[model samples]
Target chain A: MRLTRRDALAVLAGLGITGGALGLSTLDPTAADGDGSSGDRDPAETDLLATMTAAAEVVYPSQVTGVGEFVETYVTGRSRDASRQAAMETVVSELDEIARDWHGAPFADLAADDRDDLLRELGVADSEPVPEGNVSERVRFYVVNELLYAFYASPTGGRLVGIENPIGHAGGTDSYQRAAMDGGQSDVNAGENDG
Target chain B: MADERARAPVADADVCIVGAGPAGGIVAHRLAESGQNVVVLEAGPRFDGDRREQLEAHVRPGLDGPWEMGGPRDAFSSSGESFYPLNAARVKGVGGTTLHWQGMVMRLHERDFELDSRHGVGADWPLDYDDLKPYYAEAERELGVAGAMDNPYAPPRDDPFPMTAFPPSHSDSIFAEACERLGLDMHSVPSARNAEPYDGRSPCVGYGTCKPVCPSGAKYTAESHVEKAEAAGARVIDRARVRRLEHDESGERVVAAAYTTPDGETHRQAADQFVVACGGVETVRLLLLSESDRHPNGLANSSGVLGRYFMDHLFAGMGGRLDRPTRQNHVGFNTSECHQFYDDTEPVNGVKLEFLNYAGPSPVIDALHADTWGDELLEQLDESYGTHISMGALVEQLPRADNYVGLDRETTDDLGDPVPEVHWSIDDQTKTALSRANEVQASVLDELGVDVEWTVGPDNTGPAFHHMGTARMGDDPDSSVVDAECRTHDVRNLWIAGSSVFPTGGAMNPTLTIAALAVRLASSLRARLS
Candidate 1:
C-alpha cells in the first residue's frame, strides 16, 4: 500500500517486464542485474547506488570528478530495510529510463545543465517537500532530497562548507564562539553554521 | 561515596530525610552541622567522578543516556493534553534533578508572594517575601551565586552577589541591543556557576554543555551539597528507594520511613524528624503511598490537598534568523533576561524573556532536502548558521486545583508501586498569557532585524518536569496542604521542601527559591531538633 521511494521504483522497474505501458522499456533490468557482485549485494542494488550517485551529481556536480562516485558509495552504504531493497532497485532503474528519454543517455551521463533542467521540471526547486508525496513523485524525490543526503553525507561534501567533520563523521567545532570570547571581541557577525 | 552505593545496616538517626537531593543536602548539612544525626536516602547512585566526564553531553540531559535518568516510566503526560515533558527532564541520583539544571538562578518577584491580593487567583503564601528574603540571601551565599551587584531589574537585596557576572558573549550583545531598542529592561540571569574559583570548584569554561551534565562541576549540582552534608556528619545511602512513610497510630506524626534496596531488601529507619525533599512529584507520591485507614485517602490527606494546584511557567517560544551572519551568543546557558514584563503584571500572568542556546541542525537538514545543494548549501550555512536565535518568554501560570498529580490505580512501577498520574491542561488564563508572550517575543525579534520563524505557546504548550504545588504551602488547613514552614498541616513533625510546597510559582527559575525554602526549612528543623 504505502511504498518508499525505493519500493515504488522496484515495482515500476518490474512493470517494464510487461513492456511499453508508460514507455518504460529501458527501465527493465537485464538477466545480469541481480548477479550479487559484492558480498551478496544484488547487481540491481549496485545499479540503484549508481543512479543515486548520478542524481547527487545533478545537485552537486562532480566538478573535479569522483564527487558522483562519492555520493553513490555513501548513499549505498546506508542500510534501510532489505525487505524493501528490491523496490529501491526498481526506483533506481526507472530513473535511468526517465533520463534516457529526456537526454538519450543514462541519468549519470547527462550534461550538468540538462540534469538541472530536469530537476527543475520535477519541481525540486518548488516549495513542495519530497517525502510528503507518493509514487507519482518518486523520481524527483530520489534525484533531489535522497541524492542530496547521500552527497552531503560524504567527507568531500562536508569540506565544501568548511565543516571538517559533521555529526556521524568524526570530530567537530568544539566551541563556535569560545575563541571570540577569549579574544575579548564581544560582537561577532561572521560564522558558518553546520546543521 | 561517589558511585560506591553504600549500604549501611544502621537504622537509627536523629533525622531522616527522604530524597538525597538539593533540599536534602541543605537540610542534612544544616542539621548535621548542628550535631543531629541525619540519614539521607537516595534512589539512584552517583556517577563515579571518572565517569561523570563521559556522561556529560551537549544534548539535553533527558536524551543523553538511560543510566542518568532514574525512577519509573516518566509519564506525567499520561493524561494532560499539553506537551509537558515530565519524565525526560528530571534526574533522580544523589544530586536529584539539579544534576542537569541550566543554573539560570533568579529570585521570585517581591509581589510574587501576594498572588491572591494581586490577581484574585492562586492563593497567597502564609509568609511574605520579607520572611524568606533573609534565607534567600543565605542560600545565595551557600551557592556562591554570580550576578551584577546593582542589577536594575532585580528585586531589592541587602548584599551583592558573591561573584561578578561572566563577560557577555555575542548572544548577550544581540539581546542587549534589542532590549535597548525596544526600551525594555534586560539583566544577566544570576548564575550558580562560579565566575572564579570558589569553594574549591573551578569556574565555568563556557563549554556550552551545562545542561544534561556539567563535567567540570563548575555549575553547582546538589551533589556538591550532598558532599558537604556528608562531610558535616550526615550519611547518604544511595539506591535506597523510600517507598512509604510509617506514622504513629493517630497518623498525626511521622515515626519512621521504609525504603527498599536495589536487590529487594527492605529497611526501615526511625527518626524524630522526617523531611520529604524528593521534589514535587515523588514527594507527593510517597505521601500517597503511605496511606492507612487512619489516613485513608493518603498520608497528610486530611486537607485533601495532597496533590493539587500543580504549576509550571508557560514558556512561549519565538525563533528567527537574522538577515546578516551574527555570532549566536548561546555558548553558555541563556544569560540575558528581559524582566520589563515581569513586574506590574496581574497575578494571573507575567512574562520573563529568556534566550535559549540553539545551534539548530534544521537549516543544514533543510538544505540537504531543498532546491539548493553543494556550494550553494555551503553559502547558506555561512549565512544562516550562527544567525539562528530563540526568544522564549517564561510566562507565569497560576496554580489550579484540577491540574494535579495523583496515583493511577492501573499503572505500577518496577517495584509494584502505583505510578503518579498527572492531569494537566493549560487553562484560558494560560492561553491569554501565551498569546501575550508570543507578541512580546515577536516584537523583540523584530528589533533584532530577523524574520520570526515560529511561535510556541498554549496551543502546543508542553507539560513539565518542573513540578510544583501538589502539596502547596499556605496558611489554611482546609484550602492547602502545608503551612508557611513547609510542614504538612496534618503531620506536625513531618515536613516537605522543594518547589512542591510553592503556593505560587513566580515568573522565574524555581531552584533558587527551592534552595531558599530549604534553608528556611533547615532553620525551622534546627529549632525543632533543639
Candidate 2:
C-alpha cells in the first residue's frame, strides 16, 4: 500500500503520539540487540510491520482510522536504517516472547484486549523509554514513542490539533503574523466539549 | 616538513583577500567594481547544492548540522573556564557565518566608541561612530536592510533603510503589552532579511530555520556579494585554506600568502596588498603561525597584542508559561527589541533585550513524552503546547588581557598546524550585566502574569559568538596591531578586516559594523592602489 502523508496522519491519529519523548535524553543511535537475542533469531527475519500494526490497534484510540497501510510504509522506511531496524526487530521478538508466555500465541495473533493487557503487565508505562534499557523501555522508545513522533510531525496530525504546519514545513509569513486557526484547541477537545 | 612541499603559483592579483565571508566579500566586491584584480581564498566549499536538502538534514533527527563543511578540518580546543563550542557557532564557506547567522544587523551605539573616554572602562575606538556613519549607510543599502526609524536609542542615520521592517510575530505583541505597562519601549529590530524583494532575493517566507538554513533565499547571506564580486572579475577559490602569510626580507610588507589545497599541495598567491579577513580566531591563528626570524613574535605583532583582548557577547534569558495561547513557533526570527539600557554603562554593562518567538515546547516532542497515552495524551498536549513565552538579553562582555586566542600546541587540525585555543571566562562585570538584564526580563514577564519556568544568568550564560577585539585597532602602535585605517602598523601593505579590529564591542550584533569597516577599507585601498 502506498502511504501518502494523509495516510501517515491517519496512522498518527490512531497512535496518539506527540512531543516530549526525544527530549528525555538522546537515545544511543547504535544500541546493540538485547542479550536475550529472541532465542538467537536474527532481527532481520522478524515481521516488524505486522507486529507493530497489531500493537497499534491496541494503543490507538478506538475512533482512529487508517492504521494498516501507513504502518506498512512507516515500518518499511524505518527498516532502511540498519540500527533502527535492529532495535525494532529485537523489541518485536521480545514482545512476541511475552505474548507466547502469557497467552500462548504470537503478539500479532493475540486478541486486541489481550495485547493491551500484556503491554500494561510488562510495566512499559512506568519505565523511562531508554534505548539501551530493559525490554519494556526499548518497547516504549522504539515502538510507542516512534509512532507518536511520526504522526505529530506530519501535516495532517499537526493540523488536526490546530498546528496547521509543524516546524521545518514552510507556512509563509502570514502564519507567523496570524494566530493559529484553532488556538491550539484540538478536535479531541471539541468532541469532549460537544458531549 | 609541510613547508618544504613545492609551491605552485595560484594567481597574481592587485589584492588578495584571505577569506570569503562578509568582510572579505564586501571588500572584494567594492574593489573589483573599481576594475582592480582581486582574489578571495576560502577554507570551505561553497554550499551551492539544493538548500531544501540541507534544510531536511537540519530538521531530521540523528543527522549532522545543516552544513557538511565543518568536519575534522575545523577542529579547535577550548581551555577557558567555560568550554567554548567553537565549531558549532561558525561556518566556513563563501558566505561564512552569515550563511547560518540569524540575519540581525544592529549598529554600535555612539557611546560604544567612547567606552574608555566616557565610562573609564575598555579602550576607546580610534575612530568615532561618525567616521563609520556613511559606510554604515552604504552597507545597509548593499545588504538590503529592513528597518523602522522608531529606534530612539540607536545612533542617528542620515539615510533610510532599503526596505521597511517586518511586522512583529504574534507572540511579540504579547510581550509588547507587558513592556508598555512597565514603561519600556519596544522597537523593530533592523535585520538583513528582506521584508520585500529588493536585491533580486525573495522576501522572508518564514521557513523558521533561519539559523542553520533559509531554503527560500529570503535571508541575506554574503554569497550574493561573493557572486557580485566574481561578476565584477574577482576570482574566489573555495576549499583553499591559507596556511601562513609570507613577508618580505625587511618584514615591512606582506609579499605573498601560502595556502594548502585539498590534495595537500601548497600554493603561493602573490599580491601587491593582502587583507586578512579570516575572522577573529583564525586571523590570530594565521598571524601566529607565520612567525619568522625577523618577526619572532608574529606578523603584525610588533606591539605584542595580535591575539590579546579577545571578546564575545554573553546572554541572559528567562522562559515562562502563560495561561493564554502565545502562538509560539509561528515565526523563526525575532522582530521586537528593547535598547533602553544600552547607553547606561555605569555599575553594569549595556544590555539589549529581545522577545523570543520560538519559546514553547515542540508539540511533537511534548506529546511523545506524555505520561498518558490515547485520549489523555491529547489532553496533555492541548494543555501544554502553545503557552510558552521567553525573553532574552545580549550582555556586553568587557575585554580582559587573559581572555585571548592563543595557539594550542597539543591540538592540530587537518593541516598539521596548531589549532586556535580560546581562553574565555565570564568576568564579574559581565555577570553584573547579566543579572541586570535578567531583572529587566523578569519584570516584563511578571507583569504578564507568567509562571516563571527557567532563568539563564551568569552561571548558564553562553557566548553569542560575536568574536571581536583580538586584533584591536588603535592610533598607538605600542598597544594595537592595526591602525585606525585597519592597515597593520608593523606591515604597511597588510590590512585586517571584520570584527577582529573592533576595539570595544557594544551589546549589539557585529555584522553591520563588520560590513561598514569592510566598505571603508575597500575605499582606502582604492586610493592607495591608484
Native contact recovery (fnat) for each candidate is 0.14, 0.38
| Tens digits of per-residue lDDT for model 2, B294-396 | 7898898989988889999998999999987777775568889999999985544779999898887766656666665665666677776778999989999
- Best candidate, lDDT: 2
> Model 1: per-residue lDDT, tens digit, B398-429?
89888888888788888888888777778888
Interface RMSD of each: 11.9, 9.4
- Global fold similarity of model 2 (TM-score): 0.82
Model 2 captures what fraction of native contacts? Answer: 0.38
Models 1 onward score TM values of 0.72, 0.82
Q: Please state the CAPRI-style docking class of candidate 2.
A: incorrect
Report each candidate's C-alpha RMSD, comma-separated, in the order given: 12.0, 8.5
> What do the candidate models score in CA lDDT, each in turn?
0.67, 0.79
Model 1's CAPRI class is incorrect
